[model samples]
Target: MTPFTSRIYLLRHGEIVEQDVLAGGTDLLLSDVGFSQLSQACKYLTDVELVQSSTLKRCSEFATQFSHNHQIPLLLTDDIREFNFGDWDGRKYDELWELTHSPSIGDFWQSPWLVTPPCGENMADFYQRVFLWWQRLLMNIVNNHTHKQLVITHAGVIKQLLGIICELPKESNQQNMFAVGYGKFVCVEIYIDNMGKAWPKIVF
Candidate 1:
């Protein structure tokens, strides 16, 4: 077996106007500042061969525009959508805090895996789905000899991917949190061995 190198650029969408509102899975578009942020960051992208994004407009809007501008093939999938807040989708955190009165909201921030929002996606299921999508993405790039691929997605998705690549513990410990900010990106390089095993290295 021959070894190869592939890069995946994990991009978090830009700032949204509704930052205060918990907008998970709400289909909110980017703010003007958000668009401007992404536009400035686009200068760093070079030699990108493929582009992918969440089906949500906030992510897909920028991905579509960037892919079209660069003339790269773009794929929109829901696999990378943010963790569904469910009933708490549009509510503000302070309101939920007052209603619950258990500091569950605060606890959730510290240990999301241990605390799930009402009717929201549990950490286990969210991890499973996102990891499944990530594996498929890696295999696709390796088989196709794709050198560089950009993925526009949510912060939760990015953090989970980072945890997987970094071999972080499954527990929701605040110290272990890997946060990716809006309009920012993390690059990982996939390394294939002679036996066809693939490992990832955080490049940028």
Candidate 2:
């Protein structure tokens, strides 16, 4: 079946005030270095008619600048915010690991479905919310007049979306596989076929 296609830029937030932390749902603002990285991304962005960002400051701060500068529309939503790390949120990796040795970080990554973080978000729930948001995105854009969109979110969100687009297994380590750096953007070309199935491809 024939399909209509559009592009969406998925961007990860830049460096934050608290460095070397888990940083999920921490609500930390961008560091100087982080803001610079986003400035570079801004120069690269073109033909983007709309901007959407996580409610978190690191993402919303830059998105606000981009939208205002380019006079494009902007939407802030919690659906695309980083997965909440719960008790481990905003803690240093080494410190948190040493502090709470019950659930090994290594084990969690290897088998997230089995090893749940201490009061942290389980992998399954994170996956559900992200994919559901994606479905809604496709539904919203499928029938509307053409508009290019940009999404500013966290590393986890970007990685999950990549896994979905590439059809990768849930057991794989998306963090290492995708390895999206701060301020980098992945251009995903999305097509909704006549049957309303969505197909996505990363355009780098």
Q: Model 1 reaches what TM-score against the true structure?
A: 0.91
Q: Estimate each model's TM-score.
A: 0.91, 0.90
Candidate 1 displacement at residue 75 in angstroms:
0.8
| lDDT score, candidate 2, position 143 | 64
For candidate 2, report its TM-score.
Answer: 0.90
**Per the 3 Å backbone cut-off, how many clashing residue pairs does candidate 1 have?**
0
Give stretches of model 1 more than 4 Å off: 101-103, 174-176
Clashing pairs in 1: none
Residue-wise C-alpha lDDT for candidate 1, range 25-135, written one tens digit per residue: 889999999988888877878999989999999889988999999899999998899989777787887776666544366777777778787778877888888889989
- Deviation of model 1 at 56, angstroms: 1.0
Pairs of colliding residues, candidate 2: none
lDDT of each: 0.83, 0.85
Model 1 is weakest, by summed lDDT over 10 consecutive residues, at 169-178
